[model samples]
Target: MARLYDYFLGGKDNFAADRAAAEKILEVAPELPAAARANRAFLGRAVRHLARNGITQFLDLGTGLPAPGNVHEVAQEVDPGARVVYVDHDPVVLVHARALLEGQGGTGVVHGDLREPEAILRDPGVLEAIDFGRPLGVLLGAVMHHIADSERPGEIVAALREAMAPGSFLVMSHGSSEARPAAVERCTEVYRSAGLPLTPRDRDEIGALFEGFELVDPGLVWLPQWRPDLSDMIDFAAAGPQASLGLCGVGVKR
Candidate 1:
């Protein structure tokens, strides 16, 4: 799944199998590459927003293969001293993240699963870089759709929120089945065939994950509509239905 995402972002780190899978999925939804780029843009915007609002610590859950505009890169742009920890269960992602983040002050990488918030919350790597006592940003960018209902993704988010301080923020963007159900269905099947499940949830289902967190301005909306800069608006201005396929928002813990 990580490698496939890398391919979508035009990175060279993907394998032929991943390319094949991505191509197959694209056959069903050719506008997906644009969506991927838009999602990354949303992530950058969210990180910057959190940083500008005095969020000094960040826990980037399910951090995928290293790419441009990383959490630390975006956050530090606002505050040079901002601390960030990248977490992912994949060994390859961990190795790459460590290699890239090495010697970079105020940053750490941990090999952890998003499904197990308890382990991540207690992980020494996370604890070292993130102070749970203070407000922080939890970034769940385009990763929650992989967790099926059976896995109780809402509970996973609730656990993270429980650990956050009052002013902490949860910045996330998730795939939605509402925009293009047929395209999403086809893509979900492709991911499942690759042993990675995709379960795009509805607005209410995604909003439920932020039970204790109050959504900031704009609330839960399509990716392009959430505080879009001029470029973001221009990019999706002429795009197809895929532009609305993702739901994103930033919420603060009450």
Candidate 2:
């Protein structure tokens, strides 16, 4: 799934199988590439916003294949002393992250599953990079949707939220079915066929994932609606709501 996502983002880390799966999905929803770009842009904006606000540590859950404008890059650009712990269950993602994403002094990679927040929270590398007593950013970009309701995704989020300190930030983006149901269904079929179950939630359900935290400006809107850049502004308006099949927001634990 990570490799398939890498293909969607035009990265070269994907295999032919990943490409095949992504191509099938693209045939169903042609706007996916644009949506992936919008989601990536949101990640950068969210990380920059948190960094600028003095949050020096970040925990990037389900960190996919290494790419430009990654969390460490964006955060370290703002403050070289900023620390980041990239966690992903996929061995391929961890290998790529450790080789290409981890930097000296402050950045590290840990192989962990998002379903088990307790193990991730107690990871030695993660603990070394982040201080639970201080404010930090927890980035769950395009990850929670992969977890089904049977997995109790809400409880998983709540556990992570419980581990966070006051003033900590939670930045998330999830696949949403609100904009175009038919398109999302078709895309979901493609993923399911590939053995990757996708459970895109509606606006209210996605919004509920932020329980116990206060939303930031432009709360839980379309991905492009959250502090869009110039290109995002122009492209999203031209593509309409379909260009934003994903919902994104940031919240602070207060």
Candidate 3:
């Protein structure tokens, strides 16, 4: 999935098999690449927004294959010393992230799963870079949907919330079953046939994921609708025939 996502983002760090699989999926839903870009675009906006709002610590869950606007790069732009810990279960992702941060102080990567919040929280690398006593920006970008309902995603998220400080923020985006239903269904079918099960939740279900936190302004909205700037709007317009299938928001732990 990581490699496939890297392909979706037009990154070069993907294998031939990954490319072939992505091409096959694209044939089913031609707009998928556009939808994927929507998530990437939103991440830039969300991280930049969070950083400007005084978040110096970031815990990015499922950090996938690194791309142009990494969380550390965006956050560190606001404060050079901003600390970020990228967590991913994939060895390739971890290797790339680690190599990228070899000499980069205040940024690190950890091998962890989204389902095991406690393990992630206790990771020495995560602990060293982040101070839990202070506000932290925990990013769950487009990862929840891949988690099966049987994994108890809500409980997993709740555990992470419980560990956050009062002023901390939860920056997240999840696949929505409500938006572009046909596109969503087609994408889901292809992914499932590829042995990847998707569990896109409805607006209400996605909203419930942020239960313990107070949503920031323009709460739980489609990708294009969530705090988009003029450039973002222009980009979205250019990426025509796209589905705004991702529901995203920034929520404070207050």
Give RMSD to native, each candidate: 1.1, 1.0, 1.7
lDDT of model 3, residue 66: 91
**Regions more than 4 Å wrong, model 3:** 238-242
Instruction: Report the candidate with higher lDDT, 1 versus 2.
Output: 2
The residue pairs that clash in candidate 2, if any, are none
Spell out the clash pairs found in candidate 3: none
The regions of model 2 sitting more than 4 angstroms off are none
lDDT of 2 by residue, 1-254 (tens): 88988988899998888898899999988888888888899999999999999999999999899888989889989999999999999999988888885346689999899999999999998898899999999999999999999999999999999999999999999999887899999999999999998999998999999999999998888988898877876656776845778999999999
The CA lDDT of each predicted structure is: 0.90, 0.91, 0.87
Pairs that collide in candidate 1 are: none
lDDT of 1 by residue, 69-140 (tens): 999999999999999999999888988998998899999999899999999999998888889999999999
Residues 1-254, model 3: lDDT tens digits: 88898998788999998888899888866766777787888888998998898999999999999998999899889889899999999899999998998999889999998889999999998898899999999999999999989999999999999999999999899988876688778879889888876899998998999999999989988786778776656645754323657789889999
Comparing 2 with 3 on TM-score, the higher-scoring candidate is 2
What TM-score goes with each of the models? Answer: 0.97, 0.97, 0.95
What is the alpha-carbon lDDT for the whole of candidate 1?
0.90
What shift in Å separates residue 40 of candidate 1 from its native position after superposition? 0.7
All candidates in order of lDDT, best leading = 2, 1, 3
Model 2 vs truth, CA RMSD: 1.0
